[model samples]
Target: MINLQWQSFSKEECAKKLRTDIAKGLSQQQAASRLRTAGPNELAKPKKKKLLVRFFAQFCDFLVIMLLTAAGISFAVSFYRHSSDYIDSIIILAIVIINAIIGVVQESRAENAIEALQKLSSPCARVVRGGKEYAVPAEKLVPGDIVILKTGNLVPADIRLTESSSLQVEESALTGESIPSSKKAETVFPPATPFSDCRNMLFS
Candidate 1:
């Protein structure tokens, strides 16, 4: 696949370089072929750690290990002296257990928050294929697919517009600008243009 400087290319040039028809888009068979070649358009989630593993990981801290060692030594000394009192060793072990539980709970909550954000960002896109528009999962989108963006719709993938009318995309996530950036399909940019200045393009 070619690494295109998409912003530098004209709308027609992009369509040509992608081997797609701007008007008709890719045929069903062509889209399927491309999908197999390009794979799904989604971020790969990190492999999740098992709950037991996560719980045990909390004890990997140096301080926790040292405390555990101290508790074990204290219990041994009490046994050697023929003393029945084990309160100090027991208290230390209890504190260590509580701390581990707290750490696990916090880590689980953070994982849940990240998962929620991913779910929120995953969106369907309206795409043109075989001269007809269809609402499709963003992950199913292949390169050269023509996408239609409406107000309030998330940009599903990085795309160069073939048409636009009063298009303003909120790119604060990427550019850190509070205001929506105006987009024009006819606008052409030079090579090496800053991403924030590529008014003709939309990024996911």
Candidate 2:
């Protein structure tokens, strides 16, 4: 993992450590190598349950388990007595199966909706490589790569600003602040400083 303590270093120091030019950014070959080493810059999606597993999980609830146990016992008693009361047991089993199916359908729909929203929210980024700028999917970014940002562009990853000219960012997505925070490129803050106060760093 990349230590964010790099934020405490000067732009020149960071460039020296990352072995990239702040002015020209990383060459295409260097960016490709770093991508293999650092992996992509993307948010981790929540793990989802398989459809059959999710459907079965509904029976794991305490109330549902008890209902099943009751149904089983009722079924046994009706079988022993040879009474029409066995129809009641059948009805109970049917109700439980129907309820489980409904739960599964609802949860599957919800998961699909969440997945759609995640796809819609995927961010794109602008980066400089080999002295040329390219617009690429944000998930392809890697550490040591130089990114260019403008107003309304989402910060694709944790970044230590190398240059700033009248840069201001709305960090309410992470900090819950309602105002746009002013940014600076030259200042190095203490490592223990809170995120809301790190004017020299930008976060994804």
Candidate 1 global lDDT = 0.92
In angstroms, the error of model 2 at 178 is: 1.6
The C-alpha TM-scores of every prediction are 0.80, 0.85
Best by lDDT: 1
Count of clashes, each model? 0, 0
lDDT of 2: 0.84
Superposed on all Cα atoms, the candidates' RMSDs to the truth, in angstroms, are 3.2, 2.5
Q: How accurate locally, in lDDT, is each candidate? A: 0.92, 0.84
Off by over 4 Å in 1: 50-53, 60-73, 76-87, 94-121
- Model 2: runs farther than 4 Å from truth? 60-73, 76-84
lDDT of 2 by residue, 1-204 (tens): 376577678989888888888777888888888888877776666788887898788888888887788888998898888866777677777878888899999998998898799778888889988788998788888777789998889889889999999999988987898989999999998878888888899987
TM-score attained by model 2: 0.85
| Best TM-score among the predictions, by candidate number | 2
Per-residue lDDT of model 1, residues 106-171, tens digit only: 999999998899778779999999999999889999999999888898899988999999999999
